[model samples]
Target: MTNRFFNFNRAAPDARSDVSFTRRLVSDCVVTVGVLALFGLIAWILPAIDAPVGPEGIPSTVSTDPSNLPYYALRSVFRMAIALFISLIFTFVYGLAAARSRRLGKILIPLLDILQSVPILGFLSATVTIWLALFPGSMMGVEAASIFAIFTSQAWNMTFAFYRSLQSEPKELDEAVRNLRLSHWQRFWVLDVPNSMIPLLWNMMMSVGGGWFFLTASEMISVNNRTYALPGIGSYVEAAAAEQQPDKIGWAILTMVIVVVAIDILVWKPLTAWAEKFRITQSESTEPKRSAVLTLIRQSHIDDLLARILRPLGQFLDWITRPLGRTGSKWGAKPSRRRAGDIVFAAIIGILVIAGTAELMISIARTTGLAELGTAFGLGSITFLRVALLTALCSIVWVPVGAIIGMNPKVSRLIQPLVQVLASFPANFIFPFVVMVFVLWNISINWGSILLMALGTQWYILFNVIAGASAIPDDLVEMTRNFHITGWMKWKTLILPAVFGSWVTGGITAAGGAWNASIVSEIVSYGHHTLVAKGLGSYIAEATAHAEGMKTIIGVTVMAIFVVAVNYLFWNPLERLAARRFNIA
Candidate 1:
C-alpha cells in the first residue's frame, strides 16, 4: 500500500497537471491579457459615461449630474488605487517597526493610535500648509494634500492590523521561525506579511468605507470656503450636495455601494480565500510550500530575474545590519548600552525641539509678536480639555460593552464588522443632519461638535476592550468558572483584570483619537451659518482658512504636546500596571 502511494515514477500526473504547460501558460496569459484589456476598456469608457451631453455636445468636465456614472466610477477607481498604494507602504513601515523592536514598538504603536484619532479635516488643514510650502508655485500641492488626506483615512487601520498580528503571532509559529534561523527580512516577507493578510484585507475593506467618510474633505478642497475641487467621486458628491440635487447624490451613493460590493467580491474575497490556505498548522501539513500564488511566483522567471538584481542589495543591507548585531546579547543586552542608545535618541529629539523652537521664535519675530504664541497655546488648552473629557467619557461608555462582547465569541463574531463599519463611517457625512437637529432642538453647536469627534474616538476603546476580553487566558476563565464566579463579582475579580491590558491599549488609542478628533470637534457647520466653538480645532480651522502660519503651527505644536504629555502621565503608568498584572507567565 505504501509502495503504491509512493510510486511517483510510474504514477500519472495529477488531473490539473495533465494539461500541457503550453496550454496552461496560454490560458494564464489570456486571463492576464483579458484582465488588462478590461481594465483599459474601463479606464477609457469611465470618463465618457458621465460626459454631459449639453446643447452642443459632451461637456469638457463633469457637471452636477450623478447620472454621469462613468466620471464618478473613474474617480472612484483612481482614488481607491491611490489610497491602496499609500496604505500598503504605511503598513509595511509601521508593521516592520512595531515587530522589530519592543521599545520602539511601544512608542510607535501608541503614536499610531494618536495618528488615527486625528480628524480627516484636521489632517487636511494641517498638511495643506506643508504641501503648499513644499511645492510652492505648483498645482501638485493640493493634489499631494489630497493624497495625504486619503492616506490618513486608510493607513491607520492597516497598520493596526499588521502590528497586532506581529505582536500576537502564535508561540509555535515563533518557535518555528527561531528553529529555521530565518533572517528578519525573510521572517517578515515569508511569515509576518502572509499571516497579517487576512486581518489586513478586512481592514482594507473597512478603509474603503472609511475613505468615503473623508471623501468630501479629500476631494472638495475647502478651507474657509477657499474651495478647489478634484475631478473625483468626492468632488462630484460635494457638487451634488451643494446644488441640493438628490438625483446626483443618490447616484453618487449608489456608485459608492457598487464600488464597495465590487471590492468585496473581487479583491477581499479572493485574498481571504488565499489567506485560509496559508493558515495550515504544523500538525496539518508537512509541506514547505505556502500559498499557490507564492509558490508560482517563487518558480517564475520574473522572480528569478528580481532575485538576481536584489542579491547585491540584500548583501549590502546585511553588511550594514551586521555591525548592529554585535552590540550585545540577543535578549539580555547591557543596561548601560541600551541607556546609551536611549540617550542618543533623546538627544536627537531634544535637538529637533530646540531647533524648531528657535525657528518658531525667529518666525514670530518676523511675522508677529511673541504674545501670539501664548494666545494660540491658551486656545489650544481649551481643545485639549475637550479632547480629554470626551475621551474619558467615551471609554466609560464603550469599554464595558466591548469587554462583554469580547468575552462572548458569538457576540463578537456577529458585531465586530458592524463596529468596524460604524467606527469608519465618516462623522462629517452626518454633520449636516447633526447641525440641523441641534438647531431645531436649540442645542449648542459645541455639544454637536463633541459628538462628531467622539464618533471616531469611541470605537478605539471598544475594539481594544473586545480584543482584551477575547485575549484573557482560557485557564484563568476556566478557573473562575470552576469556582462558580458570576455577575459583577466575576467581572471585578476576573474579567476586568484579565482584560486590563487591552483596556489600557484601547484607552491610549481612544485618547489619542479624541485629541485629533477635537480639531474637527471644535468647528461646527449649519449650512450657510457656521458655528466656531471655543476650542483648538476651531482655532486651527480659522488659521488654516486664512493661511495663518504662526497660529496653525503653534496650534499643532500645542496639540502634540498635550497628546504626548497625557500619554506619558496617564497611559504609560497604566500600561506598566497592566503588563505587571497581566504578564502571560
Candidate 2:
C-alpha cells in the first residue's frame, strides 16, 4: 500500500513539471510575437517616410483629432529614438577624440562650442536645403531635416558630459589599463566607456529632454515664408495652437505625460537599475536595486537564445578592436617623433580651417556689410548680458535645491520622472499664454526674455546637480552626520566641493541653452501681437525666417565669439579649479 501511494505522488509531481514546461514555452512564444509586431510596425512607418511629398512639399498634413494622437506620438517617439541613436554615436566619436589628445582637442573642442551655440532655426535654415536635395520630392527629406535638428540639440549635451567624465577619470584606473597591456583603443572601449557610464546615462536623459524642448521647431518650421510641417506630436501642438484649441492643447499635454511615463517604465528604469552595478564602491551595495524588466529578461529563455545568436558578432568586434588598440612605434615612444606628428596634424587642420574661413568671409561680405556685422555684434552684447544674468540667477536658485534633492535617494527616485517630464515639456506650448500676459500688461519682450530663457535652461543646472549629489558616497554622508556637521560649514566643506565639478558642467551647458533658447524667447507671437526683443536671438530668428543664410552665419559667428570668450574667461578656469580642488579620484 505504501509503495503504491509513493508512486501516485511521484506521478502527480511529474504532471506538474510538464505543465510548467508548457507555460514556459508559451511565454517565450509571446515574447517572440511581441518583437515581430514591433518590427512590422516599423516596416509600416518606413513606407510613410519614403512616400512622395504633397503639393506643399513640406508638412503634407497632420490631423489634430484625439483618435490620431497615438499615431502622432509614435511618430515623434520614433524620430526621437533615431536622433538619440545618432547622437550617442556622435558623442562617442567626438567626445573620445577630443579627450584623447590635447593637440586635437584645441580644434575639436571650440568647434563643438560653436556648433552648440548655433540656434535651432539657424541649423534648420542652413541644413534644410541639403536634406531636400538628398531626398528630392520626398517626405524623407523633411523627416531627415527634423531628425538632424533634434540631433544637434541632443548630441552636444551628451558629448560635453562624456568629455567631462573622461577628464575626471581616476589615475589609478589609467595605471591599471597600462599595467594590463591595454592599448588606446582597448582602453577606450573597455575602461573609459565603462567608467563614464553613470554620467553618460544621466546626460543622455538630459539630452533627450533637450531634444523634446525643440521638437516643435523641428517638426513645424517656416523658412522664407514657406511653411513646412510634419505628422508628429509637435506638429499636432502647432496645429492646435494655430486654431486656438485649448482643449486640444490640454489633450496633447496629457498624451505627452503618458509617453514620458511609459518611456520611464519601459526604458529608463531598467537602465538605471542596471547602472547601479557600475557605481564605484569598495564593497557590494547592501541593498541591491531592482527592475521588473531586467528581472523578466533574466528569466526569459529568449534572452539567452538571442545572446547565443549574437555571440559571433560580439567576438568579431572584439577581434577587430584588438589590433587597432596597438600603439605605433613612434607614438609615446620618443618625444621628438610625437611632437613632429602632432605639428603636422595641427598644420593640416589649420590650413583647412583657414580655407573655410576665407570662403565664408567672402560670402558674408558679399551678402552682408560691415554695418550688419556691427549690428549683430551690438545685439549679441545685449543677449550676452541677459544670458549671463539669467544663468547666474538660475544657478543661485537651483544649486542648493538640486543638492537637497540629490542627497535624498528616496526623494530623488520619487521626483526624477516628474523632473524629466517637466524638462521635456516644450516651452513653445507655453509661449502663447506668456505672450498674452505680456500683451495685456504692455510688457517688453526684452524683460520677458529673461523668464523664457530661464524656463528652458534652468533645468540643465538642476539635472546636473542631482546627478552630482546622488553620487556622493554613503560613507561620506555618514561621516559628516557623525561629526554633527550641519548648516553653512557642512555646505562649505561637503556639499559645494562635492558638486563643484558638476556645477561647472551645468553652468557651461546652461549658458549654451540660454543662448539657444534666446532664438524663440526673444521673439514671441500671439493671435495678433508679436513682441520682439532687441537681441542676437531676434536677429538670428529674423535671419533664419528670411532664409538669409549669410545673415544667419553672421549671427552664429558673433554668438560663437561670445561663447568662446565666456568659456575662456570663466568656465575653463572653474574646470581647472574643480579638477585640482575636488577631484580626489
- Model 1 residue 176 CA deviation (Å) reads 5.3
Candidate 2 lDDT by residue in tens digits, 1-585: 111211212123233344466566765676678679879879988888889977855653467898888888888989999999999999999998898778779888888888889888888888888999999989898899999999988888788888988898888887777777765655766667766776677777778888878888888877665667888888888787777777887788888889888887767776766666556656544445556665444334654455566656655665687765553222454788878988898899889989988987788778787688889999999999999999899999999988987777676667777877787777677777788889889888899999988888888888888777766777777779899999998899999998889888889888998999899899877656689999999999988888787888899999998998898899989999998998746
| Count of backbone collisions within predicted model 1 | 2
Q: Model 1: runs farther than 4 Å from truth?
A: 1-62, 69-74, 98-142, 156-176, 189-210, 223-226, 244-345, 403-413, 467-486, 489-499, 583-585
Q: Per-model C-alpha lDDT, please? A: 0.63, 0.80
* lDDT per residue as tens, model 1, 289-338: 12333323222233334456666676666466654433222664689988
TM-score of 2: 0.90
Candidate 1 structure lDDT: 0.63
Poorly placed runs, candidate 2 (over 4 Å): 1-37, 183-186, 284-290, 301-306, 326-330, 340-359
| TM-score on alpha carbons, each prediction | 0.72, 0.90
lDDT of 2: 0.80
